[model samples]
Target chain A: MRYALRGGKRLRGFLVLESAALHGISRAAALPAAAAVEALHAYSLVHDDLPCMDDDDLRRGQPTVHVRWDEATAVLAGDALQTLAFELCCDPVLGPAERRVALVAALAKASGAEGMVLGQALDIAAESAAAPLTLEEITALQAGKTGALIGFAAEAGAILAGADRLPLRAYAEAFGLAFQIADDILDVEGDPEAAGKRLGKDAGAGKATFVSLLGLERAKARAKDLVTMAELALAPYGAAAETLRDAARFAIARQS
Target chain B: MRYALRGGKRLRGFLVLESAALHGISRAAALPAAAAVEALHAYSLVHDDLPCMDDDDLRRGQPTVHVRWDEATAVLAGDALQTLAFELCCDPVLGPAERRVALVAALAKASGAEGMVLGQALDIAAESAAAPLTLEEITALQAGKTGALIGFAAEAGAILAGADRLPLRAYAEAFGLAFQIADDILDVEGDPEAAGKRLGKDAGAGKATFVSLLGLERAKARAKDLVTMAELALAPYGAAAETLRDAARFAIARQS
Candidate 1:
């Protein structure tokens, strides 16, 4: 539990909880689903830190799971954490039986291999996606790696509130893209103190980043555009989606 | 679909369907659920064969995914396939609404990091798990690595059949152990021509096996005992579980 809470930005979890609230999903019911997504986010981080993968040693300002334990234990913890996410959703205390099922479906869609795992695979692929990629390929990579999880987070929030899925999904895709752009910006100029991850690693790793391919100014402008698109997607949602809209601005505007 | 049929031992999917049938599950609904489980099994094989992980060149006598395509595509395909498994279950036509939810819940439990992925992580860890493990540790390792997925498959079958879970789970555990034992025996006796894997690679890998630690005769005997135990666990379901009972025997008795 301590490990679960310590380091994640929890922006995704917060977005989920807040969006669920916008749709009038009760706080009592939203926490487990909220935490489940967080567990998945955490699981991805742990796995990314493996020696065979990203091989980072520090995360959330503490030793990465693989660093603290052996690579095997870290792998086990991540796997356990993933299972725990679904288990939490299955918890009977969350909501009505039907609501629980809907949330599970959305969460499963986001957390599985096709969603985030597929994205990770692509991220790995991007290292060799022919040096600089075409804009379309980069967009596809971000959508899979970063966007899919965020989209799921947004859609899951809507599912939590029993909200209609169309608008929720629209907001999800926009925000997911926006978040990745913001992440790209962070790689260029964000405060090192806050992200806990070293800056400029994207270039070092030969990863394709918005700034790397698009130039810093263009990338920054694109980030703003994505944020706008995200906010526009939620416009139909009105004040109920305030937190979501703010998240859009925060995605691009934040220092870290 | 044909690719799904042609590769590998049908052990996991078979165990699942038989257990479900034991609880009087109709084959019509169970077949797709079995396929869903099989897809997950196949996806895992695809990823596991990647150069970064197992690095095997052959799986069921075909070039492994990473070997056929680059690692990234293989990874992405695995992710896509995992999502496809859940998508298959979510099909509106698959079952009653209630059963669809159950299927999703079961798949989420089995395929995610907790079940098979966690097991694989441990398998990686066991590459050097503190000198030879105690028999107890070895059992725990096998349960996580091999037993969990098989157990998940069996339990899924039982659930798909609409069987009450209590009796189904007990048999699931027993068959899981039996399946692992037979695998260990195959490592000792099987020819690569028949087995479709590099024969005796287990000993060469320094990985502990039930047969490796115990004599071959003892391993074979333990497997038989496990099958009997599996049957006893299914006793409450009576004659309906005959396929499951026989499957446990077949699972342990098979040469390769």
Candidate 2:
């Protein structure tokens, strides 16, 4: 579990911290929430790399948990990491009881059956489907699988501050799509050496990703448009949320 | 997830409900907590039955989740069920924000690293140890793997009612050990038809258990003593706690 969490961009965690900062919540107070999201993400990745799932051999330039240890260890580690995520959310340092409870509930909703799990299930089902998923279908699946947790992270500050979550949620919804499209773009054109893992997996699987459905140029265009919309959502917060706007741009501009 | 949830004894859920009722919390209001514990249990079972884990096909007289569906489905279903457990804990019907937050925190503590997961990890590590675990070691492992969640269920009512938790916690600690001992006894002497799953797995795996360490008669006696202690812990509640007492007895006497 520690190995799985050892490295990453910490994007989701960063979103939580920046959003919390906007609400005047201290980094110390928001640390658990940030860690919780990252832990949850790591768990998902660990499970997704299992033999019965994506069966990937490498993650972050190292052997996947199942490959390095064994499938049973990977499964248990993922389960424990997930449990830890919720435990972190329950930390008293998160603030008032109401805020803590709200964070717990929101994280659950974002990660559970109706959110990330549903998206994953759909993605699996799509693999065996007679026809490939349409653009809209892929979009919806991405919304759940990738967007839900990002949405939760971006909205955490507002939730902690007892402010309206709408604008941040809007920003997250757009930002998530852009982030995934960037991933799709990476899958098509990325250097495996730079990415530190296998690339072009979607093509190998013959799965319909944004790049598959829309072609390279159009997918890039769509990602940029989503980034623009994500930035626009911060108009209400003005310069107070510039870091978040940078995060939006970073989602698209990163090479890996 | 639903399939995994079906056809179980619901022992943990029952404990939560009965404990809540004793504390003057309504069954309706407590329903989510009951369901939450059951969901968490189901998730653990589903994951434990995966090919790389326990590799069991049968559960509750039906195929296990991975056997009935696929390993990927089992993984996702377990993950979703776990998330659902936390979400259920967040239900407004659980009580005031403070009570709800307490439930979330307590449940997480009981099920996470310092509790169930740590137990499971130790159990897995025991498999490759140079020597079989001692009786004391097995006891500690079961305390985490099986006892912690049961402890949480048994204490849920007091948490909800803002009552003292010590008595129930004491009762739960004893009851959980007795319950595990009963399971070990069944593994030694149970009929597969009655048990609804394979028996003698511990012996097959060369793992130490209560029966292996204590001898059958002494183990049974230990279980009986534990039940007595569990009942004695409820002395404060007197007759009002009779249902819980019956549960303690049933844990040892049940065929399955």
Candidate 3:
């Protein structure tokens, strides 16, 4: 579990903390929420790298959990990590019980059948599919696979404060899409050494992605536009959200 | 997920509903929790049946999720089912936000590294150990693997009503152990057709169990004693807990 959690941009965790800070919540109090998102993300990655799944052996430049230990250990670790995510959300330090419950509910919605899992199932189904996914299909897949959790993280702060989550939700929708697009772009052009894992596997597998559907230049342009929109969505918070604005840019700019 | 949930004893869900009734909470209000536990159990069974884990091809007299579908589908379905458990706990109909949060927290603790997952890891580790587990070690493993969730289910009603949970907790501890011991007994002597799934696999695999460690006769005696203890623990509830008492007796007496 610990190995699966190590070495990531922690963009989701960053969103949780930043969103919490915007709602006048202390970073310390919000730490559990940040940890929850990261743990959940790690669980997804561990399972994703399983032999029956993506079958990846490298993650963050290190041997994947299944490779480092064994498949059973990896499965148990990932399952435990996922349970830990919900446990963390219930931490009293996170806030009132109502808020904690809200977090748990939102997290379940985002990560379960309705969200990330659905996206993954779709991706897997597409692998053996008769035809490559269309642009719209790819977008829908990314929305569930990546957009959902990011949406939860960005909206968490507002939830903590019982404030409206629309602005942050809007910001996250664009930011998450931009992040995936950047990942697609990276797969096509970035160095595997810097990426820490194999690149171009999507194309190798004949999987359609933002890059495949939009082409290199067009995909890059779309990602930029989404980042801009993400930044614009933060207008409600003014200068206080500058770090978040930078995060939006960083989403598409990071190499790994 | 639905396929995975079919045809279980549903003892855990029964405990949740029965306990809730004891606390004056309507079964209707407690339905989500009952569903949550069954979902969680189904998820565990699905994952445990994977080739990398227990490698079972059959569950509930039908093909296991991975066997019927594929490993990827099984993985995603299990993952989603777990998430659904937490989501069910957060159902508004369950009661106040505080109660819902408590359920989520407790469920996470019971199902995560500190509980069932830890027990499973230990079981896997035991498989390759230099020697078989001792009687005490096996007891400890069962406590985590099987006892934790039963404890949560038995105590859930008390949690819902903000009542003292000691009596119900005590009852569940004894009941759960008795239930597992009976399962061991069944594996030794129960008809495979009646059991609905494969039996004798534990002894076949040379895994240490109550029957293996205590001898079949002694294990049967021990299970009966535990069932008595479980029934005795419900003395405080009087006739209102008759169904639960029946459940305890049934735990040891059931053919499957």
The list of candidate 2 runs beyond 4 A from truth reads none
Which residues of candidate 3, in runs, are more than 4 Å off? none
**Each prediction's TM-score versus the true structure:** 0.85, 0.98, 0.99
Candidates 1 and 3 compared by DockQ, better number: 3
lDDT of 3 at B211: 95
Instruction: Please tell me which predicted candidate would have the highest DockQ against the true structure.
Output: 3
Q: What's the DockQ for every one of the candidates? A: 0.31, 0.82, 0.94
TM-score, predicted candidate 1 vs. hidden true structure:
0.85
Candidate 1 local distance difference test against the native: 0.71
10 residues in a row with least lDDT, candidate 2 chain A: A191-200
Ten contiguous residues minimizing lDDT sum, candidate 2 chain B? B112-121
Number of backbone collisions per candidate, in order? 3, 0, 0
Considering every candidate listed, which one attains the maximal TM-score?
3
Q: Give the native contact fraction of candidate 1.
A: 0.30
